[model samples]
Target: MRSLDSAREVCERFHPGLVKALGELTFAEREAPGSPVIDLFREHGGVGLLVPTEHGGHGADPVQAVRVMRAIGSMSPSLAAAATMHHFTAATLYALAPTEGRLTGAQIDVLKSVVPDRKIMASGWAEGRTEQNILMPAVTAVAAPGGYTLSGTKKPCSLSKSMDYLTASIAVPGPTGEPELAMAIIPADSPGISVHPFWGNDVLAAAESDEVRLENVFVPEDLIIRTTEEDPERMEALQLAGFVWFELLISSGYAGAAAALVEKVLQRRRGSATDQIQLVVKVESAFAVLEGAARAVLDGVDGEEAVAAALVARFAAQQAIAESTATALELLGGLDFITSSDSARLASGVRPLAFHPPSRASVAEALIAYCAGDALVLA
Candidate 1:
């Protein structure tokens, strides 16, 4: 019932407590079996930012979603990852569903009844379209009596074990070589759906990434949201808009995490010196960039401005997380090298950021686009 700002305020108010809980629980098992963080999510109604009001969501804007996520990320990246999957799925639904919305009268009733009781939702995408990539499974949709059956495997689905809904991307074959991309929303217990565990129990231990296999999973047509190919100009605009919010959610969260790491370095350094003050300065500068970038995201200066801002935030946050984590190791001296402390975990996490989407190369392109006149008019 509250406004978007108010919803954000509530999340902000709970930030310190939730973050403290996260810090205490960090060394626990990666997924930790029964995570209190998951409980927190359920209690807060599963980060209601993406859910529509009609569907029991708070209906907050994407910017507010970014703020909420950043606050959560500062405390726990794993939990932040888990929470983001839900919003990402929700956003996908928003984009794909009809103008009247995807959830039907019956479906909305079921969702409202079930979502409050469910803490998570998983999303599956990334098919191995090209050969030599064992992961990308071809998308196939066969006509069934009641509806269509979806078949394929989507990789890197976060929160697979705990989520209630699995939204997957399938390449429904049509006349064209490139099958139409459609989002299929399947319940966690749907028949013929199999989830294969993927990512190792290392940095992503707490957050399980799985490969979702749909073997003739029957889904009513009403549930499918077909992706429409639009004019190049319009598609570009939509793509940019999509990136703006998604990037804000991701970049801001990483910024908060970086800030936390910096704080930890300071805390440990002042008490007992190992790493030099210059190390602190190095990380602090990264933090400064993140802060500046966050402000830019908040300000909504321009399309190009927003893209550049988000890119800067991404670069700064990753740098800060990497360096501060390294400093944590040096500050701890021999402890980090042993692979037993948070430093080891963070070191592993930083390594993957190199491969994470919106890579540095992409960020560079965004910057170049802004530098050129291309920034004018998202279209």
Candidate 2:
């Protein structure tokens, strides 16, 4: 409870009055289709939270970022889900800021316009593949005059109806004519880009996780970033940064959803002390692991180590959220379940964390190899 309260405090600190405004609407209203939650987030300057202050943004560190996500998730899981796409995209792009000559001028322009334009970016980098690393390119590209035409679809792309930019992973030829991974930052309003309905579930309808299609979409050479290393491992700096942030923020958000259910039971005082403490411990322990991983990132843990930490946090949270949500719902009792559908919906919202990118089974090999003193290879 203290952690959630602290999360709200951090939310208010970063985006003043955001928590109150989010709380103004009923959870059902906020979670419904075409909800105004994203607009609320934009109006409150949430898109700029992960962006640096010098770039006219809030400049929240990983720790504060996760805390904000928790607070927002506690209020609206859809907002948190959609915000993860925007935040992680911002984090990955700005991650290139420190190094001179790494970012093309066009790319820098995109990053600079974020805070000023209130830009919302949706990431299509994850393919959720079971055979190889999820970051492995799934988009087809053909070299054109001064750039390439990208053709692929990012299903379940969050902020589908409202995003201004789409950052996708594509494959382009390297020096030796082999296909290599590259980042493509394309405008959502581009000629050939379109959004279609894909997410059929209504659990987090406000997330706008729909299908984003790129049919003969052209991205300029300046907007595509390729790794400098010739034969870098499957996960490079860019991919690593994006993946770690993805896991941390996504888990924290789901933790918030579970927290909401826990809060209901707590507020009603329906359970014994032992039962209440068990619920709190389950959810808070998840938050604690997430916060610990975020703090480690702040302390300079990088590459595989950081990614491993994030995955551990995410998987642990997945189990904790599952167990806690069920326990909390039971503690709330059958009367609550029969009286309102909110508890059931909230419980379902946290279940997707287990189904998100780089699932527990998919990464077992990499984590095991890393533990055996071998370099972490995600392929």
Candidate 3:
């Protein structure tokens, strides 16, 4: 498994310009509601980090992607969170395309456009009032002559204003007239697609996570992605792949933020040697667990095992980050906490890791069942 230090070094080496830009942006500036850091990131091909090399992207594997996310997370959690949406949207599409032979042409075109056009994609799949799974959207898609007219809203959609394309989940009628889950890649400028401001909070302000409302927006038939009635297994596999990638990458980003706190604490050198050592150990251990999970994915492990590994790693990293951040704050003292805006902002930033999908409370039962040898279905 790649060590955390080596991963950080690799990221810095490969994307020095990005790392330098991130370093130059103060926490306050990066966290500002309409910060331009994301645009800077996009200019440096941050949007195409996961695109295949043949398509003019770096084509990073799971482990390398984890490292890059961690590196970004250490510098800016807002960017990391926003970028996660982009990377995973691409990843999910890429991972599922071959299974159903969908999006092979679209993926190529999209990936090729990402670097040259500086195009960024956003994920518009969150429906606040729905009980459906993340992969199963609540948006209604009515069949049209050459496409589907979609109507619904995805709140807290990351990269709301900057996205050139949006990959969203929608519900379309099956052969039996029942709603079936499907995804569509719609251009941001499509008629009837509106962007609304919904994220009013200070936390993650720069993420541009607002509401994307689609009102009878027509998506061409070629952009629709769904499994055939005879290929239900492909859909299941796609779901699993998406879940694993999201969990792993998202957790790595937060871990980077937590790692940053640890680095800050070390630089000050206010804490006793023992305290610092303890913090380092905790942070390193957490990263190691994440590394193991990343390696498992890179080694071709998939399905239930991959899901379980990602969950376990994410929970472990969250605990470590929480504990390490709390300890760092205590050691840094009240004077620094009261005066250092960056320190205070980072402290607040680390708290959001708990709110990501598949909350511990909701998954506790399933986790136990899995440990007892039962199938690990998150839903």
Local distance difference test values of all predictions, in order: 0.57, 0.87, 0.80
Candidate 1, run of 10 with poorest lDDT: 127-136
Candidate 1, residues 11-62: lDDT per residue as tens digits? 6553334544555665444334345676666665654567677756676655
Worst 10 residues of 2 by lDDT: 126-135
Pairs with steric clashes in candidate 3: none
Task: Identify the candidate with maximal TM-score.
Answer: 2
Give the Å shift of residue 349 in candidate 3.
0.4
Residue lDDT tens for model 2, 1-379: 6778989999999999889998999989999999999999988898899898888898999999999999999999999999998998898888777678788999989999998888899887754434445567767889999999989888778899999999888888887889888888999899999899888998989999989889999989999988666436532677888889989998999999999889988889978999999889988998899999999999999888999899888998889999999999899999888988888999989888877878778789888988899888776
Cα displacement (Å) at residue 233, model 3: 2.2
State candidate 1's TM-score. 0.73
**C-alpha TM-scores of all predictions:** 0.73, 0.96, 0.93
Worst 10 residues of 3 by lDDT: 126-135
- Per-residue CA lDDT of candidate 3, range 1-379, in tens? 1344566676765566887787787888988899987887787778767776766667788888898888888878889889888888877776653443555576557656876787888887652333445666757788999889988888788899889999887777777888777778889999999998898778788889889889999987778887686675665687678778888888888888888888877888968999999989988887779889989999999999999999999999999989988898888889988887777778778788787777788788999999999999777
**In terms of TM-score, how similar is model 2 to the real structure?**
0.96
